[model samples]
Target: MHGLVNRALQEFVKDTYGADIWGEVRDQAALPFDEFESMLHYDIRLTKLTIDAASAVLHKDAASLLEDVGSWLVSNPAQESIRRLLRFGGTTFLDFLQSLEELPGRARMALPDLDMPEIVLQTDTPGRFKLEIRWALDGMGSVLLGALRGMADDYGALVVLEAEPGREGAEIVVIDLLDAQFAAGRTFELDAQMR
Candidate 1:
């Protein structure tokens, strides 16, 4: 796992729960480092341990916690760089979905040693898209789903998400982009900024 992910988990727990809880979780997980370096790679077991500890402490499922972490990735002012990178995909929700297909490549460019997940977007029908993720680790499917949800909110797009069982090494996520209440104005503002 990447240190960025570890760092995010730490921040999410600290910000949402409390620093004290984060400290306890860290100790329970047997993590020696107080902070994770974004470009470094850590043992995947550490992430699983942290998640399990966090789940126990917060009394929430790992999936829910990961989803909230995804939301925090975009919604938190401290994560502006990542948010800006996401926005660079395009000005609209659909555009962003399409951009997901290129994320692994883009991520590799930013951090050459990073082993990013593979993302594929399929649009067989208008206003609906299917995202397939091929991850090297287990238990990250929920995190991907959460990130998509966060992206949907970031674009101010109304969306519904469904998860389907995938073949070995992959997970399929279906997204239904619904009619937006304020998308028009936001789109215009986005376009104006692009010009």
Candidate 2:
């Protein structure tokens, strides 16, 4: 697994549950180092161990913790860069939903070695979307679920989502857009100087 991915999991636990909890998780996972270097690579087994340790320490299932991690990446003030990157996909929630299909490509442009989950967005009906997420690693769709919720709030869109099992180890998420103008969303400026 990429260090960035593991580092993100570490950051999520530390930022949300407190550093002591994160330390316990790290020790339980038997991580050789205190911090995951964001640009390096590590054995995939380490990633699994960390997730398992975090789940045990936090008293939450791995899926739930990963979902929270996803939202934390987007909504946390310390991780505003991630929110900014996702917001750049659209001026509205619908537009952003459509752009999810291209997320893997966009991520590749920024970090060629970073392997992102393949996302397929299908809109067979207006105001409804089906997102199929497939990755070599499992549980990313759960994370996407949290990120989707955060994005909906970011654009002030009222959306309902459901996650179901998919064939060949894929995750299928059904999204229903209830309202496009539900509330006043957080303001975003295209130019840094404007903020």
Candidate 3:
């Protein structure tokens, strides 16, 4: 895992919960360092341990915690850099979803050592798509779900999201665009003709 992720998690806990709680979680996780440096690679196990410790201390399920973290990553002004990077993908919700396929490559360009999870987007039909995520670590599916929801919120698009079980180490997410016009606050009308 990248240190950026750990740092973000730390920030999320500290900012949301409190610095004292973060210290307790860090100690419970048996982490030696109080601060994680961005742009560095840390043991993935450390990240898992931190999450577990946080869950224990906060009395929240790991999935929900991760989801919150993901949402925070996109919605928090403190994370504007990450939000800007994501927004660069597109001007609309659909465009952003399509751009997810290239995010791994874009991330690699910025951090050569970072190995991002694979994201595949498949169109099921008009206004619907399937996102397949392949990751080595656990608990990221929920995070992705939250991130997608946050992105939808950012675009002001109303979307329905469903998660289906996939093969080991993979997650399949289904996205349905409920209303294309809702984001722009538009309405459609029909005209009838009589003979």
Candidate 4:
């Protein structure tokens, strides 16, 4: 089973990145080509898993750090429902920030020295958040924001990160690929659009 999978990976690499590099990689790794491909794939997945583990650890730490504050805010001498809303939104915002911080490091594992801007979260509704990220990339900002929306959706509500006003629309963003040097501020509103 492993051999078959490796063969498929090797074929994929050969067909994708070319055969010469694959041959050299296979020989230098000192394993059958199929096994070598499997090993490489395993290593790649392991790297991703490690980043995920690190993200989880940071998330736990962030939650723990905010737990006391959150509790106090919720259990304060204020209104009952107000306490609940503040607690829920505050905790969610902190967790989202922690997760966003881990993402840049995860991206670094794939592309070293990649510059990311400051990501801040604001909640205007229950189970909803608005993300303001100041990214410097020209054409890649919207794509990155879309990916972030997908990631946030997996955790909570639907996140829509977009530019401010008279800036960039999603439609133009999807097709325009220009290398410009300017800082862009985008707004991502997360809401219970579906869930």
Candidate 5:
């Protein structure tokens, strides 16, 4: 697993829950190191262990916790870069939906070491879609569900999304776009506070 991925989880815990909670989670996870080196690669088990520990410490379901992490990835002020990156996917929610397939390749191009899962998007019909997430690690679909919900808000789109069980180590996310333009979303500019 990429250290960046673990670090994101670590940061999420610290930022959302607090440093003390993170310390407790680290102790529960039995991680030797206090911090994850973002450029390094750690065993995938460490990721699972951290999630489990955090889940235990927070009294939250692993999947639900991961979903919060996913939402944090895009909605948190600290993660504005990721939000910007995803926002670049499209001018509207539907454009973003169609552009999902390009994300992994774009991520790899930006950070060669950042390997992520392939997401296959299937349109069931107008305004409905299914996302097949081929994640080697569990809970990515929950994360995606959170991210999708956040992005839906960011784009001012009303949507219904849920994570469903799939084969081992995979997740299926269903999305129903209720309205593409529910409201004017948060403002995003090409430049920082260019307005």
Candidate 6:
């Protein structure tokens, strides 16, 4: 699987710029799935990583970027619905992963600028939680996913920031799993995607 992924990556870059750039491009594009998903819980973890990556690379100041996005998401009406929906869903942390598809994105908009490998949320939960985010892009998407780590909530008060595959992904922000409003906060984080 690792070699297959490497070849696929080489093919991804090679088809775009010819085989001559394979070595340079491969070094960047060829990320193995296991390695890629290792940092994430396979649920919204990938989404957080993607959004964080985009936020970090698109904005100049990380603090300002998160604050701005967080504020915007909090105020946005549509995002408010997302948050409410997540809250109304259920109690388990896994329940929050359901509405990811409801994320605001027009069909014409580029998607999954950063393809997320399938993730398996490792936990003691009864049913194994797994998620896969796929994207179709006509170009134009954040190039920052190279910098965000996966996110996880222990169904407690400590939200775990899964380490990224590399040092470049998003940083571990805060882990507020204990807050009863944790699910609502996840909605706020997800709101970053709307921007």
Q: Could you say which candidate leads in TM-score? A: 2
Give the CA lDDT, 0 to 100, for residue 23 in model 4: 58
Model 4 regions lying over 4 Å from their true place: 1-98, 109-112, 139-141, 152-163, 166-195
In Å, residue 58's CA in model 2 sits off its true spot by 0.6
Which ranges of candidate 5 are over 4 A from the true structure?
Answer: 192-195
Worst 10 residues of 1 by lDDT: 183-192
Q: For candidate 4, lDDT tens digit of each residue in 34-148?
A: 3333322343343223223322433433223222222332233432332232222223433543465355565456445444444544555554444454543222233334444
lDDT of 6 by residue, 38-135 (tens): 22333333334433443343444434433334333323454454234334434544454443333323211433332433222333344332222232
The lDDT values for all models are 0.79, 0.91, 0.83, 0.37, 0.91, 0.32
- Candidate 1 lDDT: 0.79
* Deviation from native of the Cα of residue 181 in model 3, angstroms: 4.2
Q: Give the clashing pairs for model 3.
A: none
Model 6 RMSD to the real structure? 14.5
| Candidate 6 stretches greater than 4 Å from native | 1-78, 97-120, 124-132, 137-156, 166-195
Tell me the deviation in Å of residue 78 in model 4: 50
The predictions' CA RMSDs to the true structure, in order, are: 3.1, 1.0, 8.6, 18.8, 1.3, 14.5
lDDT of 5 at 109: 88
In what order do the candidates fall by TM-score, top score first? 2, 5, 3, 1, 4, 6
lDDT of 2 at 173: 87
Report the alpha-carbon TM-score of model 5 versus the true structure. Answer: 0.96
lDDT of 5 at 37: 88
Candidate 4 overall lDDT versus native: 0.37
Better of 2 and 3 by lDDT: 2
Q: What is the lDDT of residue 60 in candidate 3?
A: 97
